[model samples]
Target: MKCVAQAGLYEARIPTGAPYKLRIGWADGWEEGADPYSFPPLLSHHDLHLFAEGKHRELAHMMGAQTMTIDGVAGVRFAVWAPNAKSVSVVGDFNLWNARRHPMRLRHDGGIWELFIPNVMSGSRYKYDITGPDGARLPLHADPFALASEIPPATASVVASPLDFEWHDEEWMARRSSFHAENAPLSIYECHVGSWRRPDKDGTRILTWDELKETLIPYVVDLGFTHIELMPIMAHPFDGSWGYQPLGLFAPMPRQGNPQQLASFIDACHQAGLGVILDWVPAHFPNDLHGMARFDGTCLFEHQDPREGLHPDWHTLIYNVGRNEVRGFLIASALMWLTQYHVDGLRVDAVASMLYRDYSRPHNGWLPNYYGGRENLESVEFLRELNHAVAEYAPTALMIAEESTAWPGVTRSVDSGGLGFTYKWNMGWMHDTLSYISRDPLWRRYHHDNILFGLHYAFSEKFVLPLSHDEVVHGKGSLLSRMPGEGGTRYAGLRAYLAFMWGHPGKKLLFMGAELAQWEEWDPHGELAWNMLDTPWGRGMHALVRDLNRLHRTEPTLHQRDTHSDGFAWIIGNDTENSVFAWLRYGDDGKPVLVVCNMTPVPRIDYRIGVPLPGWWAERLNTDADDYGGGGTGNAGGRSTEQIVSHGYEQSCVLYLPPLSVLYLQHEGGAG
Candidate 1:
């Protein structure tokens, strides 16, 4: 780092790795302190090489305000990439936030500015006062790689180290690679910690990570879920955005607890046999002055052109993935969650917006790519590189994409020209199923195809059937409220729908409070109506979800071959007039699990349904049972198959299908 101290802009000579104070013609005569910039850059040569090549996977180590000791002087090393800035300075409370107190030395080769200021210890709040190319002072910006940030309403970057957590989940980490989720049952309970449960109804306080280990952990375990997918925990200013507009990618929200406590919470989950999947947002960021927007008085992280950079719906700026440094920065953020926090997976948010250049934009407001197409080629390439790096660094941690488009090969291997994700959220399935189930029961017959339509493309990619927060927020009603009925009928409908979703050919994800059939649409400020859990309908839905998850994990037929077409066979798919559907799910052992669903409030008694073998089918579960608050109308115990052939099968049975319910029956060895 060389400084310009003279009127002629001559570079001053300083001693090797020694601080030598030089007099600046414009400053007060005879500055006493040695020049901090005269020291060699702490950023490694390999880091610069990989960054220039657009492939540095760990940018957090080389950039930002990292705490380190250079030349036995305890201080923080500040580094930033501002290609267009004329000068950059480390301004903070230590120097009374004056812009000129600690001017940084620029590395002309890579446009990086760096300085090692001694005695700047942890807990110091800081910012960068950048002199733009036009020599104008821009708004002071927070450190992009700040390990921690000041609590919201106070937007200063705190000097902290992220590696302070001592992990104790080596057993979970060692065996994670063996559990390839696609081959195993993955029933995720997606939850927002702040709103999931509050200390009281007044929304007085949020449950901390320590508090959660005792409550949220055991609750999910008792419900028999395999994993917990948390809403974004990254530090963000606006609470209404639901952590989607994150500013601190590296820091866990201190409001929840310190970074290490968040780590301990994740460790607790792993120790309790539950995997943790974090919702990660790398697509866009809010235009808050202290965040990434206009850093160094230029479009440093975002694109220079609004048409190519701005997100119309989110009112945020999109990351310019074309920039090598930006790509590395985002990839490193994803890695931090896995490597540092021991997270099991990531649910990438708004991937469709990242993949398309014209997403949510009018024709006049968007720009075409280099090939004059809607595809964002740079983002596509960046995604490939990101996935590649994740595989190399965190081999067991899954990368799941929330892509809503009919993109050709989202989960395919990148080697074969694909984006390389482990699984993709089945948005099409969620939409079509919800639409069909919301219709009046009498008119449901007309739209029976809506429930079965997603199966046509189900196997195109590994899918997760998510009844997520997005479907219950904004103007959309809660899951139970979406059903077109009142009182017991709606509860019955939701139970039947949950059965269908569980038996569907994919992994499962259910948002919190959905199992309780919460009536209020999701509100960020309120805790879930926990009092509902004591009601009959609430208890019934809860019981049903518990059984669903338990059964899903125990029965190999429900998950073993989930990603293939062979596991499923329709027995009553085309019975639209009756609004009834039946199917058989099979495992490797050739045994079949029979499932029947009645969408209408009309029971079909003594109805003949085909069976592959001549055996007794025991009624394993009936959503219409009295314990579940239904009329308890179902086949008593079991039914033996008759000699009569029906529905193109060798054997058949006359059975009862309860109104607005689903039944799971297991074959009892050849009717003995």
Candidate 2:
């Protein structure tokens, strides 16, 4: 044994042969373990090269704490990338949280530190003890690629066993592509697992993944929703952020359960015919001490300059996507959800923040891009690369973008100089429609453009008309409460608006609780207002939503041509004074379906509207039906189109337009 430069530290030079445990005795105690230095490096030179090139598709397998059997000796191999760190060590329960017990060796090629700790089993909590270049010990950081983490309020990464999940989603996996096709019905029910249903009134307890599988899965299916889009379930420190600010990109949030339980829940969703989509936030990360902020006492994962790095609105650190390692890390996080957990899709959140350098920044607070433009060029490239990788790895998985801006070609192909998202949230449409629907019907004529403006760009990009959680939070009140009238009128208006949204030219996404017409805004601290269903108004609204989803899925004309302008045409779009709108929706293989909406409370008797053909038009749905809390004012079944010329069409239909309601009529292929 020889004394090293550090005091009270010694190195032993022993001939290497078969593996054996080494023991050291101190004045008060003793410790035993196989020397970490004695083991060969776990990552090969090629692995380091790929990581350096930012082309490593499976970095999760090489980085973070992974349980393995190295040279017939079972242990956990820990690895982290901190190029600027002077030294790094593994600190955890096995070593009594001592940084001096197991210092890691740095591989200079890729700036990765690794070490194999003998006899370290899975489920052991750990963190990295890093010393910056200035010789100052930085805060312990949770593993960037950790597959499992300790429940919040406890910051540590857990050594996870290799995934041994026996998946039973073969049927769903084999045909999910069809489910995501543009022509297929896409009705997404956006949900928050924590708030969907809680066991206690205080919201102190959270349900496990298995519990959600039993509750949420069947609930969504019964509601007729095609998919359940969960708000961020990634590991984040703050509960209020709603998983927006994630620290553990790879780890499943321990709040719900372990990673394996999550996989089982996803499996259950697939078996029940419900697709799962996770809200993925890669734009910024919170500055929690145990997270990736100021890692290695430097802006390692984020931009060094505040002008480029800090997100003004959120006060979060924006990732430095220009760095190869950071880009690779983010992409791997996305792939982990798709390939590892078997989620159907990822809805990238706050894409507007990532696409613009001046997002939510004051004139003097932001820096211009390299070309003197406001766009974030590096982030743009990173997004394109991420989409390409997802396409290559998980070809059938959807990559939706929650971008709020009018950025061109967001859903276009990347090879064609576009961002290449599968679908974009139609924020403009949502804003306009909500503004129009919220106004008093007496003054709605003045703002009629709000209702008609969305169609001008309806087919600009593959869109999803999202009535998301953003609309019902922070004192905005629930969707039901946003109407401009009292009592039954409010219920009628909400039903009309929902029907309008479902019939509009795009996919559909509604936040949880909207179906029941809850009056209170979303309370993240409590479960949804499910008790409201006991009320007549709530039950009526719930029934309407279920019927709407059923019709949207079964009627080809309602969903098949959602993305093509050729499938939609206006029959009476210029009737602002009457506050009435009419349109025709067509599918390749089905007869056209006519839709008419009356925003005012005054019913229009014998209202004339153009029709494409003379036929017995069967009424498919009426928002004014008594079952949906309306006055039951509607035509008997349906009306036959007369050969009277109107709105430049040879045929016309004289109909009883219900107050604050919308009607859907399908052509039955016979002239009256």
Candidate 3:
């Protein structure tokens, strides 16, 4: 054997040309592995070109540790983008965490360092040890595209084979486009799996995906909700972030079992006739040492300038969306969940923060865009590109935005110079309606505009009226506790408010504990008060929510024209003195459903409201029903409209309106 020396390492020359493994014996034990340098780079020139151009929609599959067979040998291909690193190495349990054992080969075209380490199979934990451009050793970096990760507190990336779970929701996937159509019913149950229920008394035991499959899926299905919107489930280091500040963009949270279990949970949801929407954060990320904050000892994922890079509120680093590679990275992450996990939709979080450069910043604390405008032009382009990619790649999936500002054309098509989201959270509607409902009936009259103001611009964008977890957290009180009334009156107010929301022209979303009228505000660290369901008010509130979901799904007039201007018309919108509101909703078939609400405690006998059809109107639902803990004061069955012109209608109906109640009346048939 001949030995040659280079860089303080002695390499023994072998006469054989074929690849071979080496076994090194130590004082106590021996380790054996094939040299990673024996293999060629896995990434191609075209992939790098596409990524550099911000068009690599499948980058997640290429950039991470992917299992493969090269030259008749099975192994895992590890690739990472660290352009400024002086040297990079794959270090893990396979090599006894030795960085010197496998130095990666960097392809200068895209600054991508790659190596195929044979015998490194799935379940092997690993990370990248890098020497910075300044020749200083940097902290080990977790893979940004890791498909699975070590549970938090153990900062290592786990090697995982691609998700290969067998799906049993063929029927659901086939017709998912129809389920997400604007005309279809979309009542979502916003849930935080950790706090929804606890198997233990301390509420510290978070439910795994398999646990949720057996519990959350059936519960949502039984409640008649069309979808379940899970709070962010991406891999994050902090439980307090609720998966918002995700580090592993492509990995499922290991706390919820593996990627396969999460996929199975989603499959179960689909089979149970429920769509799943995930909250995805793309605006900013925490500056954790192992995260993408200063990869390669540079601000690779975020802007270097603090004025443009830092998030004022969360103290996180704002993404450099203007960068081509960053845009591709984020879009690839969005696609991974939709395609690999079979997720139905992504609700982009902190969209308002991304939309404006000066969001939550003082005038001097922010940097203006190229045009000196507050609008983040680069972010706008990225969103449009992201939505366009989702539409092209996963046509059945939806891209929703949690945008609070009055951003025009948020849900409009990209071809028309819009952001091209399928839906936007109607934050204004949630705020104003909650405000109106929280007031005393006597004072509500003076704040009548709060309830009616939403309709003024209801059709501006496709909206999802969300009573999400935000309303019940941060000392704001539970939805039930926010009502300003005595015991029964509070329940009545909540019921009436829910009915009004359902009857309103938008899709619906309710948080987990709102159905049970849980007294405590949302606590991420604690579970919901499930014992509350044993009480009378709790049972009634739950029943009412179930029935409301049923009505929203079964009735065409209620959901068929949610985004159309013609779907809604007012009958007595200006009757603020009596604290009453009346309106009509119409479906595509022209069938009408009249809604009347009494916000005060005094019942109104013979309350007159106009109807378009002179026919027998059946009372479809009453918020004052005894089943929902109400006084049961309502029209005996229904009222027939008389041929008396009122409120510019050819027919009018007079009925007994219950105190603090909402009534739904549908035209049955025949002229009165």
Q: In model 1, how large is the Cα lDDT of residue 160?
A: 81
Question: Among these predicted structures, which one has the highest lDDT?
Answer: 2
lDDT of 2 by residue, 228-257 (tens): 999999988899999999998888788888
Q: CA lDDT of 587 in candidate 1?
A: 79
Tally clashes: model 2: 0
Query: What TM-score would each prediction reach against the true structure?
Result: 0.94, 0.98, 0.98
Backbone clashes, each candidate: 1, 0, 0
The sequence of per-residue lDDT tens digits that candidate 1 reaches over residues 168-210 is 7889888887665577898999999999988755586899999
TM-score of 3: 0.98
List per-prediction Cα lDDT, in the order shown.
Answer: 0.87, 0.92, 0.91
RMSD per prediction, one decimal? 3.5, 1.4, 1.4
Cα distance off (Å), candidate 2, residue 205: 1.1
Write the candidate numbers in order of decreasing lDDT.
2, 3, 1
Instruction: Estimate, for each residue in 456-476, the C-alpha lDDT of model 3 and write its tens digit.
Output: 989999999999999998899
lDDT of 1 at 343: 91
